[model samples]
Target chain A: MSASGYVQHYSAKVSDIYFIRPIKMFKSRFKFAQTKVAVGALLLLSCLPFAATAASLEAQLSQYAATAKAANPGFAGFSAARGEALHTRNFASGKPDTPACTSCHGKDPRSAGQTLTGKRIEAVALSVSPSRYADPAKVEKWFKRNCNEVIGRECTAQEKGDWLTFVGSR
Target chain B: MKFPTRPVSLGLLVLAFSALVFSRAQAGGGHYYPPVVDPVVKEECGSCHLAFPAAMLPAASWKRMMGELENHFGDNAAVDPALARKITAYLVANAGDAAGQRYSAKLLRGVDAASAPQRITALPQWVREHRKVPDWEWRHKDVRSKANCTACHADAELGYYED
Candidate 1:
């Protein structure tokens, strides 16, 4: 992006040295450059909202970590690897229709999934939708519903944390 | 292939009768159901499928369904207790048997609301309305689910059900 901006500025300077029609072309080029610069700024600016949510997401995980510590004296903390296993492994105890998260979410967390009713689910990977887990209420709602469906019970705080970590990294 | 005169005439009679009954059923032949207006209910219920019109079922149906969110048809759709209560209240209030839902009540014509029936699609009146739809239409790739009202009724989200 910066490289394109640099090239735009260089060409603009060269065009400025040329005459009448060149001035009009330079004006258009300058407008084009301005758009690129604004777009680049916007590209960087979009991360600001995600950054704010990133902090809140971390705080949410910390709360879960605290709960896990209370439940187990030797809690080793959340693990992305464990989260991945929990996501992929089919649990016999779970509802027959949804024995694993991958049953509906698919093997690729980065790709979309389809509900039994054929409604499309957005990709779960954080990289795909940076602000997905930003809303604590929505996050908790899905966790409550999905864990019960795929795990046959409410997931432990540790498991929730691990799952979040794994998916957030993706 | 004698033009199947008897069957064709019989089919026409059934069609004409339905046209009259359907008009009476939907109150002047409308296919609309007042969609859920409450944002909370819409969000919590509509996340997975069409937030079906509460007016399509009776109060008993809504009450029964809310009581079993843990096994909602096939998915664990349990919401927060308070939210569930709120949703139930809204649904029951607008249900087919509820006061002022006279038009919606037509859907419950032969149904025993006391049974607390669950499936809206299973409603006898609903079946009658869609009896003409081919099985292949329901199995179409984009129209895969019977829950996908919008697949045929483009304005289903807005409460209109005219195909």
Candidate 2:
């Protein structure tokens, strides 16, 4: 953030503080005796939105818990290592029509190339911003699309998790 | 001897003043609706994206984005009506608080006035430090953009260093 941006952010905070003060006062006045009840109700209401996010984060964590092993506990880096491996590992169908992930993705995930097949082989896992792959939905869409093209199957969450763990760790 | 109510009145006045300040502060982004996150949002949405740390955007941004799912960035990442309701509920629950800030992907995408690339990204001291690198090095199609510090910088996620 720039000096000007910082100043603006500060002003915005000051302005917000100025605003919420009145509402709190009014709430306290008529509801002084019922303050506990009122605050409890409001807190309950306030917490509703976060429930799903909490659930989502929990579910994701649980999934990780389920498959933290075999995938390699030391796969500690971003899931990019798996994604990198997946990118280069050639599938052995009757013959080796397609090469491994690295065959076209290049040895370095930071830099890869296209194949004769016209697929836009990009870096195994980009962590830059504007990030090349940050949207979870887009990641799923591609996984659905690419897994079929490359490995002829849908990637398991464990696989995706491993890939993300590796890539994000990077 | 009975004490006078002067101190009580003073406390009331102090409380009133503080309430006034608090209400004003709560006026903007703090006016959240509710989070509608659900199984669909968790599974389908979380597939490629960051599951959007709830506090990342103000309620207004979430409302705006949710209301327009059909054209969500040229894609329809919508779910069944019930699931949509659930997802919206989840998002509103964790929406941005005034003190914590509500940054959105769109906001972070460098489109908003505050996050615009030239103003925010390019002017960033870290970016400036790296800006010295020759265009050839950063723009190589191998990765494509010079802004991708993760290309060479190992811990781009932790923090941005001098260009």
Off by over 4 Å in 1: A1-49, A71-74, B1-28, B102-106, B132-145, B151-154
Docking class for model 1 is acceptable
How do all models score by TM-score? 0.70, 0.28
Query: Model 2 — TM-score against the truth?
Result: 0.28
Q: Write the per-residue lDDT of candidate 2 for residues B4-122, one digit (tens) a residue.
A: 79998999999999998886555432322222245566564454232444454545556666777655543345555776777777665665533444433223333343321222234
Best by DockQ: 1
RMSD values, in order shown: 12.1, 23.1
Model 2 chain A poorest ten-residue lDDT run: A125-134
> Can you list the residue pairs that collide in candidate 1?
none
List fnat per candidate, in order: 0.59, 0.00
